[model samples]
Each structure stands twice: as structure tokens, then as C-alpha cells.
Target: MILIRLESKGPIFYYSYRVGMGYKIFKFYKFRSMHTDADQMVEQLKHLNQYANDEAQTIKTKPLTRSIIAYSNHDHILVKDDELFEESEYEQFKALEDKKAFVKINNDPRITRVGKFIRNTSIDELPQLFNILIGDMSLVGNRPLPLYEAEKLTTDKTVGRFLAPAGLTGLWQVTERGKAGMSAESRCDLDIEYALKHNFWMDMKILFKTPLAALQHENV
Candidate 1:
């Protein structure tokens, strides 16, 4: 089984997964992709609820709604009930709007010098082979998500993706790998579709096509 440790760096929360017997832990290795102080900036931005736009020039605020309350942690926003937001002294509110559930800004400055190359080449994911060998992940399955992202997928409509194995590559990464500005809903739809239709043969085909997909310039 995979054991996950959730760690936060500013607004970024990621999972470090390990597999071992009681009390023993093994290190997971991967190329570094962001600056060490990245979390510090996240903490600074939590109070403002602001993030850089795709161009990395303008800062945008995440609109909130009654059903979606946003609270600040040291360096991240935690969603809870409206009461929680009030208790935390957060006052900004807006009606729910149609927007991507997940957003990745292009040309993000938080990315490190080498990060751009590795991300563009999809080389940063090479370390996951260790996870595959250790049974923490599959060669073909739904892409593993960060804790913050996973928490939002709790609804019945989006939970099916979790039924599939956490993989190094998946339907979204292949079909939409090169597409820019994909909405979160569209990505979730692909994941759900794959979860409902995945089979050994399908997995084989996805694995076969993965190399070519990775070669695309928009692999990031």
C-alpha cells in the first residue's frame, strides 16, 4: 500500500508517497522543479488570495461563493463552510461562476531554471518508475493529484477517477497533453471516461502511445 505524507510549501501542497513496513521509510527521489522558498511566497499570498495570471504579470483573486468558503492557512487557502471563513475574518464573497476546477498558470515564475526543461520534456516524471516498481503507482492509471486538488474531488460526480489506479500517465495527459487552457471540468470528464472504460487492452494502447505524446512541445 502507498503511504502518503502531505506537506505544504506556501500555497502549494504536494504528497510524498512511500511504501514500507511499520516504522521504516524509504526516500523518493525526483528532480527539483521549484525554488526552495516557493512556499514562503505562497504564505504571503494567502491573505490576499491572489495568484499570477497566465502571463505571469497580473495578479488575480479567486472569487468565492457561499457554498465555497476560503480560509487561509500559513501559506495556503483551505476551503470550508461559510462559517469557517467568517471566523477566519474572510469577507470576500461572490456568486459561484463557471470556471475550471483546476487551474495551472503558464510561465509561472515559481518554476526553477531546470524545471522548464524537465517539464516540457516530461522528464520530471521519470522518478515515478520507482513508485511503479514498489507498487505505489501503476504504469497506466489516473494521474496522482496534490492534496489540495484531491480534496475538491469529493463529490459523487468526480469520485470515480479515484477508483482507477494512480498512474504515471493517463487519458487526459495523452489526449489533451498539447492543448492549452483546458478547463478542469473537461479534464475530469476524461478521467471519468477512462475510469469507466479502462481495461488491460486499453491500458496497453495508452502506454504504447505515451512516448509520442510526451514528445509533443506542450507536454508541460
Candidate 2:
């Protein structure tokens, strides 16, 4: 089974999303995506009466809410209708998505002044190089995704076939990373298809093509 874990030390946190293949768990590193107090905040919120009531409610309005409900419906189907979340946790995710998308707009309102630069230059992905160096990812392969996209794609069965080592760049990144709003999950499947069919010469071509792709300045 694939295993992913997150941990924190002092004011900083570390995350590693790993894949279990050939009976070992390889740690894939990434920049911290949450605040140091994220867990504490979540636990504190859970203890509130208002929070409990909110958790029991259904999502019927808001774009983020609808998207989450749509995501959940798909995840349920993929899991053979098993409930992977409590109503509150799902709704909370809707809020997080909204926050993610809001600041993620062409000029995001939620991003700090520094975040824009980090995101645009792909500096945020630097941490994943550790994953590459360690063999959790290769120089060319599919992108790993957040859980939402993984859930949606599982229904296709093709997703499982793409579970080889992760990559920092792929066909999807070259084609659409900045040109389109291709979700990370969608990119994963496409990258998988490419990796499955790839050879050494083709991999070399992709590596050479990547710098040109990066120069396009489409992030703005």
C-alpha cells in the first residue's frame, strides 16, 4: 500500500508523500503546504459546538462547496461508496479549496507578497528534488497529486498504471503548466501515459524541451 506522512518540528513542518512499490515506502519531499499550527487549529475547531453543527450540514451552495461535493461524489464511487470523510471534514475542505483558489487567481488575494514569486518561478517545487534524488521520483515521470484529483481519476483505472516514480517535470508541465489551468491530478494521468511509453531518447528530448518550455513566461 502507498503511504504518505506529514510531520512538524519547531515552527516549521515537513511533508513526504510516498509510494509503496516493490514492498518499500519511498519518502517524497515537498515544501510545507500548511501552517505549523494547522493541526492544532483543526483540533480546536472540532471542539466547538458551532463546528460540530457545521460539520453535519450538506454542501448545496458556493462554487467551492459544489466542487467539493462533486469531488466527494466521485470519491465515493471510486471507493465503492465507502465514506471517507465526515460531513464536516468534507465541508472544511471546500473552505480550504476556496482559500487555495482565491489566492491562486491570476492575482490571488490570499497569497502573501512572497508567495507569488515562489509559485511563478516554480521554486516551490524545489523541495521535491529530494524525492528525485532519493528515487521516489525519476527525472521524467508523472506528477503526484493532491488527494482530490487522485480520487476522481481512480475511477478510470488507468491512474493505477501511472504509479511509477514521480517527476518534477512531464508532458503536462511542458504543455499546460502555465498555459492552462490543468489540475495537478489530470496532469498526473497524462504524464503516466507518456512515461509508460517512453524510451531513453525520448526522455532526453523531454529534458531538452523543458528549458524552452520554462522560458515561455506564461505564469503571469
Candidate 3:
């Protein structure tokens, strides 16, 4: 907290409405790991969102709505049948596709020095223990999503992830954290895998792997 204070002027905890299980919106918390103006800076950096064009999503610098980011600690899929979306929703999804559904900047300029330390060490996620206790999240499950990112993932294939609780660590965190080819669809696949097949043993395995996964090797 002191490091965050010393490095910048803002609330030490960053809170935003994150889409959770069953598409529920909840206040997600994290240590503030970026400059105060980070949210406003999103649009300017949209061109860097990374995509292999698995389906041709233009990679741009990208926008992360939640402040503390390391693959978001958090960050998707598209609807197959266009008929499912209402006209307004379809238009928004198109804009979102153009905006890029997933974004993780390689060397984001908005992060503060202390922010960088907390993020790399996964210390920024400590605040979420409260969410776990209060039932907004859990110790093991899929990570929650920011509204912008969640809006693009309601298709039948990807929406299954919401069956499990949101968590601090999950399948993707342990398995795909730093994989260069980890696409948005692949992340959702892991999440869905966990949702459909998660059990006590699996959760324990994930919990065991978390410490290792949390020790990330790159800057985001």
C-alpha cells in the first residue's frame, strides 16, 4: 500500500465492475498497478491487441478495463450464430471485434514502478481474498472478466465457463500463463474445460501449481 502511495496519487485499491459467473456483475478488486489515468488511456493504445487471427481478430496495443493486469491475473470467444444477437448487440460486438476482445501490452507504459513490482509478484491480487470470502469469487475457478471483454464471450461455446466460480487462480493461470500462442479462444477453452470437469482433486492440483504460475517471467 505504501509503495503504491509513494509512486502515485490515487486509491490504493482498484475496483471495477467485472463480469462473473452466470454473467453476474460484481466489483472486482486489486492493488492499483497502473497510473491513475490508465482507463482513459485505453483507446489510444488499441492497435497492439495480439491475435494470431485464429479467426482474424486484428491485434492492437489493446485495452484492459481492469487496472491491475498480467493477462489480468484476468482477460475470450465470439458468437457463431449472428441471429442470437439483437441488432444493437450485434453492432456492439462488431465494434468490440474491431476494438479487439483481448489485449495484453508487452511493455505497457501506464504501469507505475511499484505497480510493476506488485503485478510481477502477484501481490496485486491480494485484495481479492476479500472477494473470495464474501462469495464474489473463490480460491479456484475461472478468473472474472471486465465488462468490455465479457460482452464478447456469450456464445454457447465460451459461455460455459461461467458455470464455475470466479477465482484467483485457475487452469489458464497454471497452464497457459506465458505461452506465446495462447489465443483468446484457447483461454476460454481452458476455462470451459475447468468448468465442465473441475473437481476437488483438480482444484487442489491447480492450487498446487499456482505458486509456480504466479511467478511469471514477463512484463505486461
Candidate 4:
């Protein structure tokens, strides 16, 4: 069994994870990165996320036929409705449509100011070192998923990702780091691949590459 405990250090409060049963559980520590009621907020936000997912699926199925028109009071107009957009325009449109599925919100009101800073610098994950030190996790392995995310991967095709220990950093996060519009399926494939092929040398390679990966804007 895995146990999560809340503890306070000075002005900061964080969670500690323990994995085991009976008298043998080991404790792991981390700094808090979210609102204190984040867990409760998840349920409230579930329908909104599901709605976003459905919207994304709908956008994927529909062909891009919508056109935009711009009006100018001057003698000439820069763009016309029927004119075809450049490749970059199409990419931008797709990205905009897909934004709902991946982006938390325009500014993400749920995230505290401190939360944003810690997340951007990867400091939010610093406490997980205790887990690594205690053997509950590794420096390089499949990232631990929240219960909601884990449930979606229970299918036979995706379950292989769980064969390895959870990590502080992993394959997809490094390889796909600044690339936009990655699907959940793609992430699962990378996790499963890492689980199947992970070894001491590969782990060391990942550990070495992690700092550069973390520097990228899209650490998710």
C-alpha cells in the first residue's frame, strides 16, 4: 500500500509518500506545489476536463473548413476570407483548437503564484529525492501518475508502463520536451518503452540528460 502524509516545515507544508504495509513503510518527502485543497478541486474540475476532451475529439473529427475575414477602412485589405492560410496559420489554428485539451486555463487561476515558479524551475519535484533515496522511486523511470491519470492507462496496451518504478524524470519528458500537441497515447508509449528497455546505462543516460530537458518550457 502507498500512504501519503502531510507535514509542515517552517512556513511550507508538503506531502510525504510511503510505500509498504504493516510496520515496514518508508517515508518520502516533497515540497508542496499546489493549493492545499487540490485533491478536492479535482472532482469539481473533472466535468470541465471531460468537456474539453470531448471538444478536442470533435475538433479532430471535423475537417478544417472555417474561414476568417478581416476588414480595413483603407483602400486595401491585408487578408481575405476565401484566401488559403499558410502552413503556419493552419498549425496555429490546430494548436488553438487543441489548447483546451491540454492547457489548464488561460492563466490557470487554480495555481498559486509560488506554484507557477516552482513548476517552471522543476523545484516542485525536489522533495521526491527522498523517495529515490529510500528506494520507493528511481532517478529515471516511468513518472508516477495520479490516480485519475493511472486509471486511463489500465488497458492491456498501456499497462506495461507500470512495470517499472515511478521516477523523478523519464523518457517522454526528455525526448518530447518542447514539442507541442502530444497525445496521451504517445506519452503512454514512451513510458512503456522506457519500462521495457530501462537499465543502469540507460538510467544514467537519462539522468545526465535530465537537466537540459528540465530547462525546456514544456516539462509536462
Candidate 5:
């Protein structure tokens, strides 16, 4: 936290909305690693993100896409269409449409000086344990999806993976760790695999192999 404070001007910890099992929305946090203006930089690097080009990741599906927002209170209000919204709400709706899945970048420019060290050392993720303790996640399961990613994952094939718990270390992270050119498709496939086959014994095996990744979330 002190190191982060030295290099960053915003909150020392940054939490974003993540979707867990049953499509539960909760705050997922890490040590602040990106620049305060990182949100503003998304458009600049949008083209570099794998999901930016993935049509499969963007198509509006049920449940998640039907979610509406009360901007004043920032609460989710479920309603079907945008025709019922105010003009300002419609603009925000378009903004949400523009969002793509979160992608992990290599040597991303948005990372601050301290950010790289924390991320590389997995210090940025220590806060995830708190989420686990709070029952927002579990010991071994799927990586929770960010809001943008979860919104599109409501598709039939991808949605079933949410049946698995969200976790700090899971089959996908350990299995795919350090592998070259890991694609979003492969990771999501692993999540589905775990969802279908996971059990106590498999969870134990996954925990044993997590050390292979040095406890990193595949940091790709």
C-alpha cells in the first residue's frame, strides 16, 4: 500500500464490479496498479484487446443484457428496452454497448512504475483473499468475470460456466499459466470444463498445482 501511495494519486486499492456464480455482482479489488486515467486510455488501446475484435464477446444476450441502471443511485433496474429510458440514459446505454471484455496486456503502458512490480509479484492480488474470506469467492474455481465480460457471457454456451464458483486460483489459471498465445476462447473453455467436472478431489488437485504458476492468475 505504501509503495502504491508513493506512485499513485487515487485510492491505494481499486475495486471494480465482477460477476461471480449465479451472476452475483460484487466488488473485486487489487492494489492500484494502473494510472488514474486508465479508464480514459481504454479507447486508445481498444484495438489491441482480443475481445475488442470478438463478436462472440459482444452480442446482447438475456439476463445480463436486460439489466438496467438507475444512474442517480447506481442501482440495477431490470427492464427490457432502451425506449423506456431518458435521453441521458440512452447515451449511457450506448456507452455500455461500447464496452468490451477486459484483457490482460503485456507491458501495458497504463501501468504505473509501482504497478508492474505489484502485478509481476502477485502482490496486487493479495486483496482477493479478502473476497474469498467474505464468501464472494472460493479457494478453487473460475476467475470471476468483469462486468463488461459478464454482460456478453449471458450466451447459452458461455453462461453455464457461471455455475462454477469464482476463485483466486482455478483450473484455467493453473492449466494455462505461462503458456504462449493463450486465447480468450481457450480460457472460457477451461472454465466450462471446470464447471462440468469440478469436485472436491479435483479442487484439491488444482490447489496442489497452483504453486506451478507461483500463485499468479496467469498474468498473461
Candidate 6:
């Protein structure tokens, strides 16, 4: 039984499912940073982004490399290095990039007052511990993504391995979840890297880093 709240203001949206093992359908949680109107907004801005690209000079760059250029003009706010999570409470967020699944707006209009606080402090992630206890998640791993993003990874060859288990906090969360800078896909790519090189000691390292990440706070 995956639990979800469309109104969540955290960094990732919480979702859960039962993958056998005699376990009940457990609840998975994540911060919801995407705008409630994200889908429509992206669709509306798609052609604009295309036009912008077509009218501009093409500069070839490496894939997944960090950039500071704001990509939100088209509502597809690509995670760059400028979106550092500075909530002070979640200082570890500094290491991560501030991005959403689809439209990664810097100052998303959907965020509520309480939602902002929860997102910044990462308090919104508290409920996931239950998932950890129930074996739905581990202390470390890659953060799960939406079905849409997962579909894009079909050719990555490493997607199945990354999705092997649930993670309380993962390489992506602890390392790439900054308050506001960094592209969403770039962070996901980093997660793929971690999954490829994962080990027990690496997992432990992430576990140790999670608390510190949570305890940090930035400018709300």
C-alpha cells in the first residue's frame, strides 16, 4: 500500500509498494518538491524551450556535467550547481542539488508555509523510518524515482540493480539533495554511479551521513 500526499512539500514524493517477502504493503515517503501544476506547466513551456534552443547558438557540452545557467524559464528547471539546499537544518542537503522530478522550480509557487519548513529541515522524511523497519528500505541506497523517470533508465543496464531494495536515505539524497542548485537528472546520474559501486562499507558511510544531513538547516 503506497501512501502519497499530492500536497507534500518535501524534496521527494513518498510512495510505497509490497514486493513480496510476506511483508505488508509498506508506506514509503519522500519530499514533494514539484509544483501541483507541474505537468501542465511543462507541457505549456515545452515548445518555448525548443524555440529557445533553436534560436540560440549550440554549445556542445558533456552530459551530466554541472551548470549554473537557470533552466527554469521553460518550467523544466534542470538541476544545476546553484540550487544549493541551505536550510541550515539539512546542511547535508548542500551536497545534493535542489531539483524535482519534472519541473524543478527554484521558488516553486506550490510550496506552503509548513511545506517550506519541512522541505528545508528534511523533517518530511521522518516517516520513511517505518519503511526501513519493515524492510521496504535500507539505511542506504539510491533514492527511488517515479515511474516516468524509471522508464528513461531502461537502457542504463544498471536500473534494476539500483532498484533492488528500499533506501531510508541514499547516495542521491545525502550527496545530491542541495537546497537549490544542480540539475535533477545530474543527481540521478550520480545515484546511478553510487549504485554501480555500492558495498556494505559504502552503505555504512551513507548511514552515518544521513543524520548530519537531517540536522542541518539553511536559509528558509
Best by TM-score: 3
Q: Encode model 4's per-residue lDDT on 170-214: one tens digit a residue.
A: 897789855655555566688889978989988888888898887
* lDDT, residue 119, candidate 5: 76
Clashes of 4: 0
For 119-213, candidate 1 gives per-residue lDDT tens digits of 77777678788877987678898877654446566677777777777778888888987676566677878988888899999999899889977
Off by over 4 Å in 5: 50-102, 215-220
Instruction: Summing lDDT over every window of 10 consecutive residues in candidate 4, give the lowest-scoring window.
Output: 1-10
Comparison by TM-score, 1 against 2, better one:
1
lDDT of 3 by residue, 58-142 (tens): 2232333333333443313223433222334444546457336667776788988888888888999999999999999999999
User: What lDDT does the true structure give each of the candidates?
Assistant: 0.58, 0.48, 0.79, 0.58, 0.74, 0.50
Give the range of the ten consecutive residues with the poorest summed lDDT in model 1. Answer: 1-10
| Model 1 global lDDT (CA atoms, 0 to 1) | 0.58
Clashing pairs in 1: 9-39, 10-39, 43-75
Candidate 5 contains a number of clashing pairs equal to: 0
Root-mean-square deviation of Cα positions for candidate 2 versus the true structure, in angstroms:
11.6
Off by over 4 Å in 3: 52-99
Candidate 1's clash total is 3
TM-score for each of the candidates: 0.63, 0.52, 0.79, 0.63, 0.73, 0.53
lDDT tens digits by residue: candidate 2, 1-220: 0111123233222464443322234555544434345334433433231212233344443233344666665442211144345445565655533322111123323333333444566655677777777667677666664333334444343455345545677676677766645443454456557757767786787788777565534323
Q: Could you tell me which residue pairs clash in candidate 5?
A: none
Kindly provide the TM-score of model 3 when superposed on the true structure, using C-alpha atoms.
Answer: 0.79
Ranking by TM-score: 3, 5, 1, 4, 6, 2
The 10-residue segment of model 5 with minimum total lDDT is 62-71
Off by over 4 Å in 6: 1-27, 30-103, 157-164, 179-181, 215-220
> What TM-score does candidate 1 reach?
0.63
Candidate 4 Cα errors over 4 Å, as ranges = 1-11, 16-29, 47-106, 216-220
| Shift in Å, residue 116, candidate 5 | 1.0
